[model samples]
Target: MDFWQWYVRRGRIDRRTWWLQYALPIGVLSVLALMADVALGNSSLESIATGETGYGPIVTLVGLLALPASVSSGATRLHDRGMSAWWLLIGLVPLFGQITLLVLTGFLRGDGGPNRYGPPPSAAPTAGPYLQPEPAPEPDRPPYWG
Candidate 1:
C-alpha cells in the first residue's frame, strides 16, 4: 500500500501492517525525543530513557502532530476486523481499555474477505477452473489362474 494509504487514508489494514504503521512513527519520534533531551543537556540519560519530561515542548508538539495519523490508521485497522472505527474510543477507558484495544488490533485477525470497509489487504488470488478428479484404477483380479 502507498504511504498515504497506510497512515492517513480511511481504509482497511491487515494486522501485520497495522503494527508497522503504528510502531514505526512512535519509535522514530521516541528516539528523536531522547536525542533532543540529550542535546539540551538539561537531563540525564536515565530521565530521557524513562520518558520523563525533559525535551520540553518539542516532544509534546511532535506527539500531537502524530496523533491524527495514529488514530486514523488505528481506525482503519478496526475496520479490517469488521468492527466500527468508533470502537477505538474505548481506549478512553484507561488501562483496561488500552489493553483491550491492543489485543483487538494486534492479536485478532481481520475478516477473510471483503467487508464494509473494502477488500482485504492480503486477498488470495481467485480460484481457477475446477479440475475433475481422476478415475480410480480397477482392482486387480484376485486369482486370474482360477
Candidate 2:
C-alpha cells in the first residue's frame, strides 16, 4: 500500500515495516528537528538529550506533524500482533506506558498467518509494506509410511 493509504491506519504491518517505514523516518526527522531547534537557540542538544529540558519548538512541531502517522502506524503494528488499535492507549501511562507499547509494537513477532487483523505484511520492501507474506515451501522428507 502507498504511504498515504497506510496512513489511514486500517491494516496490519510487520516489524520491518513498523521500523523502516514508520519509526525510522520519524526518528530521523525528529533528529533533524532537534538540530533546527538548537540552531534557533531554543534548546541545546546536550540539555535536551540529558533530559534537563524538553525538546524545543521545531522538534515539538515535527513530532506533532508526525503524530498521526506514528499513532496509525503503531496501531497497524498492534493489529499485526493480533490486537486492536486501542492498545495504543498504553502509551498514556507514566514511564512504563510508552516502554511497554514500544516493546509490544516494535519488538515482538506478529501472527504467522492470516489473522483477525489481516494477512501478514510483505517481507520485501519493494513489493510495498502491506502484502501477503510469501508462503514457506515444504521441506524434503521421507514418506510417513516408508
Candidate 3:
C-alpha cells in the first residue's frame, strides 16, 4: 500500500522496518522540535527534561500529529508477531509491560511466512488505489556508443 495506507492495522511489519521507517522518523522529529523550542527560547533544557509545564508547543504538535501513525505502526508490528493489536494494551500496566512490548516489536523476528496478519512485510510500501508513482517516459533513443 501507499505510505499513508502503510499506517493502517491491516498489514505486518518486521522489526527493521518498524524502527527505521516509523519509529526513528517520529523520534527524529520530536528531537528536532525540542531543539527548535530550546533555540527559540520557548523552553529550557531543564524544563524539557522535567516536563514541568508539559512539552513545548512544537513538540506537542509533533506528538499529536504522529500519535495515530505511531499507534498503527505498533499495532502492525504486533500483527507481525501474530498477535492482536489489543496486545498493545499491555503498555497500560506500566514500565515492565512497555519494555516487553518494545522487545517483542523492536527486537524479535516476525513469522517466517504468512500468519493471521497476511504475509511478512515486503520491506517497502507498495502502491495503493489512491496514490501511485507514474510510469517513467521511455527514452527516444537507446544510447550512444563510446
Choose the strongest candidate by lDDT: 2
Greater lDDT among 2 and 3 belongs to 2
Ranking by TM-score: 3, 2, 1
- Candidate number that wins on TM-score, 1 or 2: 2
- Over 31-108, each residue of candidate 1 has an lDDT whose tens digit, in order, gives 797578567775567775688755556666777777877888778889999999899999999999999998888889
Error of 2 at 8 (Å): 1.7
Q: Which pairs clash in model 3?
A: none
Largest TM-score belongs to which candidate? 3
Comparing 1 and 3 on lDDT, the stronger one: 3
- Could you give candidate 3's per-residue lDDT for residues 1-146 as a string of tens digits? 47776456567878888898888999899999989888888889897578686677898898998888888999999999899999988988789998998898899988888888788786445778668765555699655544
Worst 10-residue lDDT window, candidate 1: 137-146
> lDDT for every model?
0.77, 0.85, 0.83
Off by over 4 Å in 3: 1-3, 122-146
Candidate 2 residue pairs in clash (backbone atoms < 3 Å) = none
lDDT of 2: 0.85
Q: How many backbone clashes does candidate 1 have?
A: 0
